[model samples]
Target: MKNFKILNNYSIRSKLIIIYLFCVLIPMIVTNSIVYITIKSNEVREQRITMEHAIERVKYNLSSVLDDCVLVSNHLHNDITLNDFITRRYDNLLDYYERYNYLLQNNVINYYYNSQHVYQVTIYTDNDTISNSSNFRKLTSETRQSEWYRQFYNNNEDMTISVYYDDNRKNYGINNTARTISITRKLDNFDKTHENILKIDVDYNVILNDILNEKMEDNLYVCNKSYILFSNKKSNVGTEEFDTIDSIEEKDVKLNDFFRFKVANEAWNIIITANEVSPLSKIVERKEILFGLAIFNLLLPTIIIILVSHSIGYRVTLLGIYLGKVENEEFSTIEYNDGQDEIGKLIRSYNLMVLRIKELIEVVFKRDAEKQRLELAKKQAELKALQSQVNPHFMFNTLESIRMRSLIKGESETAEIIENLSALLRKTINWGEDYITIEDEMLFVENYLQIQKYRFGEKLTFSFYVMGDCKGIRIPKLSILSFVENACVHGIEEVSHNASINVSIFKYDSRLFIEISDTGSGMEEDQLNLIRDKLRNAEIDMLNNSKSTGVLNTYMRLQMYCNNNMQFEIDSKPKEGTDVTIQIFLDEPGVSNSFVKENQNNNF
Candidate 1:
């Protein structure tokens, strides 16, 4: 309930801001989160499907190559010339070479030409007559102990394919740098007494490009039962070993590292490893666009809410201000469109109430107006009487100064002091004006200070530093002189030693500054603070009760005259001195003029 009351205390604008965040922003964030998750899931599924299809295509292509190898092995096994050349013992190397040439031309050449993938064909036998060449070699104990030879010999299958370095290039005096897929098969004669090995090396590049040419964003490998047979990456062709996929129960399934597809007939499996590039690259590329959309979604509603709330709040505030005016008996009607909304209806009702109040008050106001005129005249008379009271006190002080000067100088400086007193009184009684230029006011202050100088003689000293440009600026009449009078009467008179007074007038930026400093008996901190508080609060009753009425009256009058644009400050330290500073902004000349006009209209 407490929280509810707190919420109710919030303005309509605050409520609308909260509503917009919950209703629009929260839902937008939730929807965006859900959409992002859905998109990511779909992308993952599509990537899996794509990987599976690529592996399947690789398996198909590899199977086709294995089938071709089987067909070639079958043709070589049935050929009588190749089988006879391998089984029969020749008498001489020349005769063996002739028979080997015939076998190569008739059968081996035909098989090599028919298959575009075949790199070389070789037949190795126990017969020594068959000389070692690129395509014919004599089988030995060293050849039987080789890795590819042992794999082929131990396998029970008819044909086996394994990746191996082509060592036959050594027989032809060339470096054996080519890696090839070797398809090996052991052939038996009719008596099963003689055996020979038939080997076909398929070009690894041709198999990869021509057979498994379906491009994928992943690495594809064709592995034998124990080791890799061929791979799109050359580094993994023969050096890498298979990860024991031969024992897996499922023929086509996904493994931890790769997607596996097996060809049981050839004991070969296709493994696909996904690359570093994700399949959702398109979505990642639009990251900036997604962020921009999110920001737009958040800001669009907030901007709309601010504009809408401002319209309603602004009119409501206007109504409040107008109501305050009515309560003060100003009787000003609110000026706005009579809209159809609730606030508009309230405004319309307020306008009707103001009209009725104005009409009802007119008759009574007329009678009160006459009575108020008489009362205003009486108040003006009383204000003049009150203002005249200051002059008597000032005149008595001047008379006392004249009397002191006459007794001290034996009437020699009396004439001069009396003339200065006359001039000061004339300036003070010129009450028709409330404002004068800075230059004219300084002249008046000089006259007053001059009379004081005659009374104090060398005991009181004063100086004025008025900037030429600031002399034309107008300020309240007698504002500066009041502070100077206070410095002489309250500050210098209380001290016995010679005291100095400094008055400066200058302009800084758009403001005019007047500083009056006195070296006299300064008040204590507590007394200074009390006066400062009264000046800041600007309480008329406090000013009436205070002994420093001249400073208080001057402060209040300047505040009214400048509409608080003027700044007044007092700085004093006990036994050190006191400084009074006044600053008036010159940006609005009408403020000073309006003060003079209002005071004149009031007959003060």
Candidate 2:
């Protein structure tokens, strides 16, 4: 009873009221401002989107109407009874012609001359002018002469885009105030006895009504090339929608790119405005209630909250440390406790997440590069072994030739072969990164050509031109040299000195292009096909060999470093020449000019 008296003091009530005012008022001001701004932004975005979609819907409606008009015109354009109606003689074709006009007037057009049913078409012939219909009839009709008419006449009476004050206005005089968008196209030439122009006057109101008077609970307006066609503002039709009738600005909004264009392609625009107070008013009410509740119940809840804050001081400190680490994005370690309290469980879960993140960082970022380095070392060794075998084979083969020549009546032409072979062997065993400057690689090819020239004697000739800016560019080991060796082995066996090799490297438009041409027995289509199949299957062996062993290992290494869009082109003709084109993108992806990850810390 004494503690209750202490808790019920005026000082405690005043403190609680101050706490409530500070806490609730700050949050209310902030929350209300934030809520107000967020809702306004979203409303703007949603209104813009809805406006764009509404404009599209309007265009679609207009386009559909135009399509219906075209369908009717196309049918009448090929009509058979049209010729009889234009001749102004209702013979055996009156019923057929009346039916034609009826089909045209499905819901839109209702005009004819010598048309038995509705409004009349007036025409002036060389002899007389006449128009006769059920509701509207004329006897001495003056020729329909106007600038609009002559434009159609000179255009072979094809079509004129015009609007009408009324769909029922067939000629010069009509009292109706309503209007329509229409097209008029001639069915045949004026000289012939055939149907003249087919006139289409469609009601544009139905289309405008659907979008302009939409029940969106938002105001929508639509504009055309000439005027604001309609709006929900209770303005009259044909009222221009915007004061700025400039071209439809691409409002930087995401829009669907489908254009169901209306005839004459009168591009339309839309603007949307939604009611603002509806959404935000609720937020305002919520803030008021929360603030009022905080005021009324202020004292008791505050005393209880203060007691809890003092009791949980240590736990709050621990949470603050953990939150600091999280803000720094360093989750190397975390604290855990065995207790089943909410705070204990939270710390335990957080520690588990930190361990999982460490493992994922290892897997996601580091594994691929480690695997590549190991595979690269293995391939280099394997290729070196294979390259070692080549030297001995060529040595034995050349010695055998020299012995054969010496046994006969030779002047030691084999001496030249021995020297060329020695130079080729030394260059081919490049013991470094699979890359070398173009200058170094060309020297290797020169030695290869010397060997080939010795073996084939005067039967083979070689010419190489390393062109502008291509001299010192780095390429994979043996790229051109290997091709020279291949040509020596395959092409020069049959032809004479005309059987040539030309190594030309020219840098063009920031790319490295190599053309290796040989003039011996060029490959057949079948052989080229076989080679392409082999090249396509080049990656399959590496993918299949889990051990990552290979011949042409340098080739595979270069390919791995190239972009996916890198290319090789082979052109050949039987007995002419074979041109092997290798196009290397200098800025190829995954193949940086400088070592980007060179200084990556050894984070063991």
Candidate 3:
């Protein structure tokens, strides 16, 4: 419990490192150690078993060679022709040679050709009839006392097998040298009276090659009870003695770290020494590599834990700082990173709480100030309404008095002008209404042109072409009239020649297009561009400063009322004319339905 409390006091990074070391690294090391030890134990047992089997295999192959030699000797000893050749007495030496040649061809050569390992087969006899021939020789006292001969004679068994070095060039006049394993047996007549010797020499190198080919890394020694007969190591063949065994029949004996096994029917033992390092030494050699791998395994998890813990802890610390700010009543919102994890959600929720709190506090603190602002706005609106109400009424009444006076004085043209001015004033006052129909706007434009025509006399001529159903298509009030006024003052008035103004309204699909053209003094390129730039930027102050307020004001008002759904453009050239176009998209259901109804009524 105390350790747990201590761990809790540390940061998350340290805690993660400690936990990974105990939970992941320690267990992995323990498991690997157990597995390595188990594998080493199995390897040692397998190595020992493998060496014992090798020794047995060698023993079997050597026994096979010795058995073949014994079989050949037995066959030779029982041959009647060989026994006759050995015992028969002949008078002439030449006659004895002929008989010996016959025996050599039919008996000795046949045996030699039949056996794969037998290098030669020979017979030695004490008889005076048998001369030394290719296959037989007289048995001398010196030959009978030779080491191999004595060994065979002293055995007293039917046959004896031993390995000795023989030169075929000196013994049988063959072109070969071999370490040979010889099998010797005593031969007797059919009556079992006298005896001769039959010997079969087998190529020991051939037998050993077949048996010991696979055990190149091991040392094999074939030894009898007294001395080593043949060995893979040539230096030890004649000099090495058989190590004393506690039991002659010991199957597999471990002596001086070498394994020894005895041949089945012979006194010989096959000693095998494996050319392999001890298991413990191998483990020690690879200890550094294992340690390095273990360290890398532990370090990999440590790094990953450190990185993850740092990320989480950093985000949490940032959240804490934001919370502290809130506690101090700063009420600032954190810049949300838009992460979708738990921390992101927490930050978003905290920002929402701060916004709600800010809104509540604003309401509580600024309530009285907001009320005063509203009261002031109300008074200003009333004053504007009073000014709007009294001015238009006074202007209308004055214009009516002037029209009556002119009619009474027989000035009917002047009276008609006064009436047109009063109508324009009334339309201008009604501009406070947000929207007016195309027909109402067109009527206002006509009234405006009448006043201009009266002023210009015969110099100003105008035409209106209202194409398609344009009656109830609602647009911002004063949108069309402002451009009409511009055409009169700038386009028509400046040209000295008689000028014409054309106002065209047409509907194409769901949009209404209006064009106002005047054949008057148009602007230069630079002046036209300047006016265009000012209107495009909705620079009302700049336009008023430059005495081009009407078009700029109309453009801004159209933008404000139409949410910029209307298109406005002005095209002009010096002394030719000016064309101003306004395109209004009629996509709203209220406006479209009103226009459709108005069109139906007109058609009916």
Best by lDDT: 1
Model 2 Cα lDDT, one tens digit per residue, 1-604: 2233332223434545655665566556755666666576766677667767676676666567666665555555565544334445444445545754764565223432222211223222322222344321222223245433444455453445444334233333332224445456665543355334555555454555565555565555555445444556553343222333343334532332333334443345555554444345545556765576456456555665564444344555776797688788777455545334455556677788878877877895478788899999999999999978766666667766775666566556666556566666655554567666678888888877787677677778899899745666666677777777767766777655458899888877656788898987888999888666656667746546534223235345556656443577777888887888877776445654421232122110
Q: Among these predicted structures, which one has the highest TM-score?
A: 2
Candidate 3 wrongly placed segments (more than 4 Å): 1-391, 508-511, 533-547, 556-569, 583-604
Model 2 Cα displacement at 89 (Å)? 30
lDDT of 3 at 197: 80
TM for every model, in the order presented, reads 0.38, 0.40, 0.38
| Sequence-dependent TM-score of model 3 | 0.38
Model 2 spans > 4 angstroms off: 1-184, 187-189, 193-412, 456-460, 488-499, 519-567, 572-577, 585-604
User: Relative to the true structure, how large is the alpha-carbon lDDT of every model?
Assistant: 0.71, 0.57, 0.70
Q: Kindly indicate the candidate among 2 and 3 with the higher TM-score.
A: 2
- Each candidate's number of clashing pairs is 0, 4, 0
Judged by whole-model lDDT over C-alpha atoms, candidate 1 comes out at 0.71
Residue lDDT tens for model 3, 1-604: 2222333334555666776776587757865685567566776577677767766776677667666766777677777887887888888988887886786577554755476777777788888676776567678898786766887877776667755554433344342444455777778636366557877777655665655465555555656665545455443122233333432234433322222222223466666555443444454456765587567666776765665555456667888998999889888778845445566667788889999889877886588688899999999999998878766677799889999999999999999988988888887776665677788889888888888888999999999999747866666688788888888877887778999999999989867789999889999999989887777777556755665577777788777655677788888988899999888776644333444555466552
lDDT preference between candidates 1 and 2, better one: 1
Selected candidate, larger lDDT, 2 vs 3: 3
Q: How do all the candidates rank in terms of lDDT, highest first?
A: 1, 3, 2
What residue pairs are clashing in model 2?
112-121, 186-197, 228-240, 228-241
RMSD of 2: 17.2
